[model samples]
Target chain A: MTIVAKFEIPYLRFLDSEGKINKPLPHFAKNSRDLISLYRTMVLTRTFDAKAINLQRTGKLGTYPSSLGQEAISTAIGAAMQPNDVFCPAYREYAAQLQRGVTMAEILAYWSGDERGNQFAANPEDLPIYVPLATQCLHAAGIASAFKLRNQPRVVIVVCGDGATSRGDFYEAINLAGVWQLPIVFVVNNNQWAISVPRTAQTNAATLAQKAIAGGFAGEQVDGNDVIAVKYALDNAIAKARAGSGPSLIEAITYRLCDHTTADDAKRYWDPQTVEQAWQEEPIKRLRQYLIKNKHWDETQEAHLQVECNQQIEQAVTEYMNLPPAKLTDMFDYLYASLPAIYLEQRREVEI
Target chain B: MSEITLVEAVNQALAYEMQADDNVVLLGEDIAKNGGVFRSTVGLLERFGPQRVLDTPLAESMIAGVSIGMAMQGLKPVAEFQFMGFMYAGMEHIISHASRIRNRTRGRLTCPLVFRTPYGAGIHAPEHHSESTEALFAHIPGLRVVIPSSPVRAYGLLLAAIRDPDPVIFLEPTRIYRLVKQTVPDNGQALPLDKCFVLREGSDITLVTWGNMVYETLKAAGQLAEQNIQAEVIDVATIKPLDMQTILASVEKTGRCVIIHEAARTCGVGAEIAAQLAERCLLCLMAPVKRVTGYDTIVPYAKMEKHYLPTAEKIIKAVEDVLSYEG
Candidate 1:
């Protein structure tokens, strides 16, 4: 048999597990401020995640998913996208959503089962968190299609998990993106686990990034624990899409360092030793190591930043807890643009 | 006004909407070049150009999900499924995102789209090709499930479905797509949704139906007219947010009712109508409500299609049974 096609997936990592610079720093990393800002946001994300888990444990919040080890990936994505560009994210992108102007209270409100949480007042245009896996991939393609049709220089970025890659939606979306040459980016947070199922069990493909090749676009892997690499890949992909060069896929290979959600028990499926070993390459620790090694950060700065993150999270939590319950009629009021006359009678009987 | 078939009327409505609104777009498999599997979108690709009439890859879920995304951006996307059977692959998107986006976002984001598909089990189609599961969509809160019986209603209702500010499931009856013709004007006047259309007036009994079953029910009404039964026929156009008041008024006048549908007997739209009539019109009724529907089994292939579909004879029988009640 003759080979009709050939392809390769290039891996990228600016800093290794020990925080050693593997190569010369990219332009963004050469400036200490950019890296420091990224570092600050990631730390805030981790702090927020921990506080969310604590709230869930204390019966203050509903089931919540923590992006404990994958802060770099989500934070980098939020930084890469512009304000006008749409973000069609699956659940579990709190870091990105926070960066995109969604308030911590709004995010908390969603997990607490209030309809208003999805309003995204500041970022009203971005998609709300949809629970279904990878279904938003097509939404990204469709949003990109609109931009292309209207000749707007806008990009759409959609994120999903490794398990979502096994779904037809992911494939169909990437395929449509390729066919239309739509302005979109598909980012897979290959966090090595989809709840109890591991990456190996989710697909037989050697790498999730290579899946984009089948869709007639470029795909590559980035060190999700390395914020510089994640941001670099996202910046390139978003720029390409904005320039009308079509779509790209970036597989951010990170590890899920926490349970899938408050309702899930990853310890039942994960090995203690394996979890311990993964901590060595967690995003925040390596970034902190790099900053400290470069003298851009000191013990005094780190201690003050931690206090600020805690104070911000505490204020958001206080605001969220004091919020009033949504009206019972909110469900009916927003069911349509205006309630149909036929449903008005039924709407009146909406009792507890 | 031009006399056109039901499918032709659909094409007219789509063409009119695309010309009137720049945000209106069409997307589906084989829709752009092939003019749709049923030719309901004929000449759209040429008229609107590729930018508006997009021929997407053969993926049902993507068609639906992408439509929601496009709708969120202020574009009205009329996405087509090859058949009602193919809609199962896309229901998660429709039921989850399209139906819930408005409520989930508290009106911040909305899905203003029309999901069109051909339904019902006549004309000798394949197994998965013929499906009439309108109840599943009607049960959802944010959706408006519409099925037109004739060319005029099809044109008016389709125009309305596309213009409505929310998600609408426009299920065209494949059995009657080209079965009959009517003088439908392309004046761009959309028929009112959430209302039933009275096809015939009578005092003896009410024949409530929509889609292909409306044809059979109307035929049954005619047969009853020959027998001096004088049956009233009503097409419940928008099944969800149902125009029950019209049906209730007709039932209150006729004192008897027979609900007919092409979908399965179990948990069908007919069942919902019958239940509502029982609750609202029990005091007005002269007889127990009856339903004439397809059986609760797989929609058979070509050979058994005639046996599976509700016929004029079966509708007449159900009407007679309801009329024979002696309360």
Candidate 2:
């Protein structure tokens, strides 16, 4: 038989689950300051996740999706992206949003069903949270196409969940990106579950990363629990995109250690044993152990950071709580550039 | 002054806008080298180059979502679905993102994109290729549904659609794309959207229609005029954020209305207009508001299509029934 072609998916891992270096550390690992910053953000994200769950349980907030074991993926994304680059995020990407300068109060307001949360002044041009699974992949491809058209140096990083990779929108987007050689980086968080359905049912593909090959781009995998590995992969992808080399797909393998959302009861379908197993490789603890093993962080520093995270989160919660509710007319004001007669008449009926 | 068919007029509008605005771009399947399946985008890629006129892969949802992204980032992208029947694949993006982005972002980000596709049944086309589903887009809150009947209106309204601050669904009448030619001035002028164009004035009855139905309604009005029963013709250019003021004023004058459209009758745009007129101008209406539209069934294949569309004769009969009604 004549050989036509062959392909191999690259895998990346800098640290083992126990915090020991399994491979040569990437450049980001050599910078203790950057590593410490990533650790701090991951800690802060976890702290926020716990408080958010409490808020939901106490009826103070709406159902919130936690970033439990996947903190490293979002942290690496946020830390590695340039300010000018656009971040297209899925709903579960609260950690990434926070890293990109979105305030905790803003996220809280959004989960509470307030439109004001999407008005991000810090990341003015960034796309707001996408709720419909893989649709943002196309939006990112479009944004990247615009950058290419204008000859801009900026790149777009669009993140989606493992299940989103099964959607036609994801394939269509990556196909177009490949055809146009658009400046985009697609990061799929393969967290092993899509609500009640497991990853095995979503696709029979060997690795989610390999799906990029069908769309004519390079695909690679990374240990999502290892922030250094994610950062390394994301940095290289973004750099390649900005340099106009074309788009790349990075699948960050992780595990969902919590229920899909506050509204879900994973205990109904998930085996408790698997959940217990996933907790062993959780990202926050892995990074913390690494920091402690390197002597860059001690028990005293960890305790201080915890107290600080609590104070900051409490302040944000208080600020969000004290704000006045949005007005009804606010709905009519933004529906169009100018209010038409139909809306005016409707508004008048409501005024009385 | 130049005489051009409606399809040529569409090409003119796209070419003119691409020249006038650096941000205006065209993207669709076979639009670049093939100049589109209908040649509505002929000479665009040659004039604007591949950068401005992109030939995308055969994916409708991506075409729509990408346009939204481009529009958000200060580019005016005009995306084309090969036909309206093929638009259902893109309906998710159109309904979810295109229509709600402006309101969702509180005016911080607006989608200034135009989704163009040819609609209506005629010319012996296949089943899905001939669909008049403008009402679907018109029903969307944040979208402006614009349809043009003649060459002149096609050129003018298309420019306005691309220039609109929000998303607009520009549905072209496939039947009349090359059926007739009119002297359309090449001047880069756009007609006002969200306004009804009164084609022929009469105080007897208002014949409200848009897209290809406008042609039949005009023909029916002429036949009605010969019978000494003058019928007014009003082309509703913009279906959503409908120009009800103009329609209501005409109905108030004529005291009768006969809406015509080649879309499914149930929950169609004609139903909305009829309901609105009944609510606001009930006392002024001399007779019941009537609708001459396509059946509630799926548009039939080529052999059965002509029997499915709304015709001038059908429109005239409805006007006669409303005019002669005692109730």
Best DockQ among the predictions, by candidate number: 1
**Tens-digit per-residue lDDT, B9-96, candidate 1:** 9999999999999999999989998999899998999999999998888889999999999999999999999998999999999998
lDDT of 1 by residue, A1-352 (tens): 9999999999999999888999888898999998989999999999999999999999999999999999999899898989999998878788899999998999898898887888888987899886888888988888888899899999999999999999998999989999889999999999999899999998889999999999999999999999999999999999999999999999999999999999999989999998899999999989889999999999999999999999999999998998899878887899999898877878788855
Per-residue accuracy of model 2 over A118-209 as CA lDDT, tens digit each: 98867788888888889999999989989999999999999999999999999999899898999999999999999999999999999999
Residue-wise lDDT of candidate 2 within B251-325, one digit each (tens)? 999999999999999999999999999899999999999999999999999998889998989998999999999
Query: Candidate 1: where are CA atoms >4 Å away?
Result: none
Worst 10 residues of 1 chain B by lDDT: B318-327
RMSD per model, one decimal = 1.3, 1.0
Q: What is the lDDT of residue A117 in candidate 2?
A: 87
Residue A167 Cα positional deviation in candidate 2, in Å, after optimal superposition: 0.5
Candidate 2 chain A lDDT trough over 10 residues, lowest sum: A343-352
Clashing pairs for predicted structure model 2, backbone only: none
True contacts kept of 2: 0.76
